[model samples]
Target: MANPSLKACFDRKKFVVAPGIFDMISAKVADGMGFDCLYVTGFGTVASGLGLPDAGIATYTDMISRIGRFAQMSRTPVIADADTGYGGLLNVRHTVMGYEAAGVSGIQLEDQEVPKKCGHTPGRRVIPAEEMVLKIKVAAEARRDPNFLIVARTDARTGLGLEEAIRRGRMYGEAGADIVFIESPESEAEMVAIGKAITDKPLLANNVEGGRTPILSKARLEEIGYGIAIYPAVGFLAAAAALERAYSHLKTAGDSNGLPASESYGFGRICELMGFPEVWDFERRWAQPAAKE
Candidate 1:
């Protein structure tokens, strides 16, 4: 059965914290660790899958394939970052349908142009508010399932200003966006103002590490009236740091003896976590069945 829709989470009024996952292994790990939802981050996807930055370098096919893997491997609902819906109004429709068919519970579209950068990164630019509004409308109309969420994101905070960001967010919500995300609010006061200004729809907060926005706890975010908080780089950054340490230790010590056992997962444990046992069981049951006498 499908996991509960993100709309259910919103209806419950509970703050949903979706950890970002880029690949199959991370998706399985997050599901096993009991995360109710997973975010298919564009930044993590480009970094991990393509060995590139999130500067709109990943193509729509790249994102769809990556997000499809996550949705297939994870038991939790997946919310995908569909950056700028990959193009204009028609492109937004196609992106929405493709993601929904891939089993994504939600799709996030931004207001930036084709070569959109990461929300926290500098040199980001947004299209006109009316242009984004049309995209949002097309995205909302494209989903076959009403429960499939449309998250409209505005990168106008740093470019145009907080007030303009708020205005764009409100416009998006009015255009049928299930959620409005104002990217990179510089201060808590700005967050509060956004929360107050956009009250008609649920809001999503991007909790990017070392990014522009302040990292607030889930409790505090709920207090600030955010319905969803996504930690888009926690897993990727941690994995990168650990790999760096592991490589350095191997170069110096010539072995992994110095690595802490608690922090490391053994080969067999990793296989189990990835359901190798189930694969073997299926093989035994079907591939080489016992004699029926």
Candidate 2:
């Protein structure tokens, strides 16, 4: 089970910091760090898994399969991005079933149209508020587990302005969403406004590095009255930098011996991380060598 259910975390009234984990490597590393929740970032996951941009190119099948694996491997509660619920009302129902059965504790459903763009990126448009409200209603009803969360994300901030985004956030909350995400609030004042307007449910703050929203500390966000803060870009960005440095060093130096990165997390440590000890123990117990004579 997702230890300390995400709903419980919200009910606790303390801030929750969920790191964005894109792949199993990051997943294993993040899950062990003891965060109350983990966010499956669509931008990083789609890029890593499919070598595609997160402009709604990946299908529901693509996202659910990857998210399912992460949720299974993780002992922590996972909140995955389910873009636009993959389609309309019927699709929303199916997505809820798939994500719930796949062990995701929460799903972030955005209000962008089909082929949705990333939240902080430009040229994003939202579906009518009325349309997204119904999607939220269907998603809320489709979830079998009552605690399975429905996070309604409004990308209206970039296009429609802050007031409209906050209005939509309030609407979604009233429509039974467990949390509200107002994407791309450019200023701290806008964030404070969002926090104040949407009071019924927990507010999710997207702390994307270099994104429109300023990166505030957990304490600042809690002070601003946000409930969940997802740092979705940190893992992928860090991984990209590390891989680039290592690859650049290897190509330049022609040897792994004198690399810039410390090699302490080498083969043995990685093997332990990948649970090789259990495999070796299984082999020892089941594959005892037979006597020659």
What does candidate 1's lDDT look like per residue over 1-293, in tens digits?
A: 22456679888787788999987878888988876679988999899899999999888888888788788777789899999988888888899989988888899999997799999889999999999989988887788887788889999999899999999999999999989999999888999898888887888999988999998888888887899999989999998888888888889999888787766778899999988999999888888656798
How well does candidate 2 match the true structure in TM-score terms?
Answer: 0.97
* Model 2 spans with C-alpha error above 4 angstroms: 1-4, 261-264, 290-293
List RMSD in Å for every model shown.
2.6, 1.4
Candidate number with greatest TM-score:
2
How many clashing pairs does model 2 include? Answer: 0
Number of backbone-clashing residue pairs for each candidate, in the order shown? 0, 0
153: Cα error in model 1, Å: 0.3
lDDT of 1 at 67: 87
Q: What TM-score would each prediction reach against the true structure?
A: 0.95, 0.97
State in Å the error of residue 139, model 2. 0.4
- Error at 159, model 1, angstroms: 1.1
List the global CA lDDT of all models: 0.87, 0.90
Please list the residue runs of candidate 1 whose C-alpha ends up more than 4 Å from where it truly belongs after superposition.
1-4, 286-293
What TM-score quantifies how close candidate 1 is to the native fold?
Answer: 0.95
